[model samples]
Target chain A: AQSVTQLDSHVSVSEGTPVLLRCNYSSSYSPSLFWYVQHPNKGLQLLLKYTSAATLVKGINGFEAEFKKSETSFHLTKPSAHMSDAAEYFCVVSDRNGNEKLTFGTGTRLTIIP
Target chain B: GAGVSQTPSNKVTEKGKYVELRCDPISGHTALYWYRQSLGQGPEFLIYFQGTGAADDSGLPNDRFFAVRPEGSVSTLKIQRTERGDSAVYLCASSLMVGGRDEQFFGPGTRLTVL
Candidate 1:
């Protein structure tokens, strides 16, 4: 079974400070990892994805994640946090095989302090 | 141009009632999916459709949950004998194609409240 675990349920960071949201995944095969963000009353938006290509994947809104195979981690990070970055983040995993169903982590709510 | 869209942004129903949620995928998207998200939890997969056929429905919690994607464009999820536990947000997503790397675009989701 492929699954993802988000280390923090909530993360608070001041504006202009660095941000880190940790995630760990478990999969039998080489899995596809993704980070998604959801704002209040909005849909889930794709942040970044790792598909066995480069370990470091950059996404929209100045977000990025690194896939670490040895550590089974794909942590999302940003150099600086903005008030607009406050949202719920989810770490997702899917089988590399054609099955596109995603297994999502509980989620981490990020609060950007202004 | 438009992302996935779901109908009935909010629905209130009583127990033992039947409810149907609709989803319209992006134009030309070949794959659609349904997921349920409870408060304080991530979305849980319910089913997947490729074209007009259901490729996988294993994630459905019970037989009371059923979905159809006829004509390969619009989809509907039907639930029978709704329970209070079934109250949650139902999300729909679509992808250009079914692949490991394909990104699934999500809808705003339909919030179902069972009384």
Candidate 2:
């Protein structure tokens, strides 16, 4: 079985400060990991994905995540947080063996304070 | 539409009633998926279809749920004898192919409320 665990249920950060959302995964095979952000009343938008080619993957709106095998972690980070970045984020994992079913983490609600 | 589309953004139904939710995948997309999300939770996989066949349905919670894609372009999720526990945001996504590396494009989702 494959699953993902998002360490924090909620995270708060002041505007312009750095942000981090932690996630970990357990899969029988090498996994494809992705981070997605969903604004209020909006569909989820892809932030980034790690397909095994690169451990450090960059995404839109200045977001990035690193895949670490030893740690079994794929944590998302941003150098600075903006008010618009406040949203719900999901960490998803899928095995490279073509399972095609993505297992999603519980989710992390991000709040940016002005 | 250029992206995955779902109908009836909001639905309210009474317990014991039947409900049907629809999804339209992107043009030429052969892989379609359905997921359910409750409040404060991430989307949970329910079922997946490749072309006209259901490739995987292991994630469906119970037999009360059923889905179909007759033509491989549009799909519908059907619920029988719905209960309050069935209330959730039903999300639909589609990808160009069925693979681990392919990205799934999501729809806005249908929020279902059971009373």
Candidate 3:
């Protein structure tokens, strides 16, 4: 079975400050990881994905995540936080054996202060 | 140009009643997925369909939950004897492929509230 764990339930950052959301995963095969963001009353939007092509994956809205095989982590980071960055983020993982089903983490709520 | 779409943005039903939710995937997407999200929790996988067949139904909580994608495009999820615990935001997503590397595009989700 595959699973993902988000280290933080909530994270708050001031505008223009750095932001980080930690995540870890356990998978039997080579893992395909992803980050998704959900705004209030909206569906989830894909942020970034790691499919073994690149360790450093860049996403929309200045977001990026590094896939560290050694740490079993794929933590999302932003150089500077914006007010619109406040939303719920999820870490996801899928089995490399062509299993289309994705396992999601509990989620981390991001709050950006002005 | 169309994305995944789900019907009945919100549903309120009494316990013991049956409910059916609908989903329409992108024009050529061959893969569809269903998930349930409770308040303040991550979405839990329910089922996955590849083409006209269910590739995976292991995440289904019980036999009361069932889904079908007969024509390989539109799908329906049926829940029998609805319980309050079944109340949640039911999300539908679709991807270009049935592989792990494909990105899944999501719909607005149907918020089902059981009373």
Candidate 4:
């Protein structure tokens, strides 16, 4: 069984400040992790993915996440926050052995203050 | 060139009625998926299709839910005897045939309201 847990349901950050959205996971097998962003009334967009390559992964729009196997975490981070970055973020995990089913976290809602 | 598209952005129906939602995947994408998302929760997997066959339907809640991808490009999800609990956003996603590394592209999703 594989599951993901997002520590924060909502996070607020001021513009130009650093942003952090924490996520943790439990997987029996080697897992593939992904971060997806969803704006209001829009579809989910892939931000980044980790497939047992580098521990640190960079994504679109200045977002990045570090895969820590020891901690069972893959927390998303950004050096600076922008207004457009306010959205819902989901942490997903899947099996590495060709399992296409993605187990998604409850999601973290990000709010950016001007 | 285009991304995944799902038909009927919104659907409202009375309980016990049947409904069908459709999805058109991106060109050349061989893997399609269906999920249901309730408010304040992440999407729950319903089914997955590889090419024209359903690779996995274990996530489906019950026999009332069925899906078909006759030609491997377009797919349909049919739900029978709808209940108020069935109200949720139905999402469709597609990915290239790259096994575990495929990054899924999602559609806007259909908002179903069961009355």
Q: On residues B1-115, what C-alpha lDDT tens digit does candidate 1 reach at each position?
A: 5889999999999999999999999999999999999999999999999999999999999999999988999999999999999999999999989964578999999999999
Clashes of 2: 0
What candidate 3 gets wrong by more than 4 Å, as runs, is A97-99
- Interface RMSD, one decimal, each candidate: 1.8, 2.0, 1.9, 1.9
Cα lDDT tens digits for candidate 4, B42-80: 999999999999998999999999999999999999999
Q: lDDT of model 4 at residue A37?
A: 97
Which CAPRI category fits model 1?
medium
In candidate 3, list every pair of residues with a backbone clash. Answer: none
Rank by DockQ (best first)? 1, 3, 4, 2
lDDT of 3 by residue, B1-115 (tens): 5888999999999999999999999889999999999999999999999999998999999999999998999999999999999999999999888864667999999999999
| Alpha-carbon lDDT, every model | 0.95, 0.93, 0.93, 0.94
Q: For every candidate structure, what is the RMSD over all alpha carbons to the true structure, in angstroms?
A: 1.0, 1.1, 1.1, 1.0
How would you encode candidate 2's per-residue C-alpha lDDT over A5-71 as one tens digit per residue?
A: 9999999999999999999999999888999999999998889998878899999999999999999
B1-115: candidate 2 lDDT, tens digit per residue: 5988999999999999999999999999899999999998899999999899999999899999999999999999999999999999999999888864678889999999999
Evaluated on chain A only, model 2 obtains a TM-score of 0.96
Q: Locate the minimum summed-lDDT window of 10 residues in model 3 chain A.
A: A94-103
Candidate 3 chain B least-lDDT 10 residues: B95-104
lDDT of 4 by residue, A1-114 (tens): 999999999999999999999999999999999999999999999999999999999999999999999999999999999999999999999976534989999999999999
Report the poorest 10 consecutive residues by lDDT, candidate 4 chain A.
A94-103
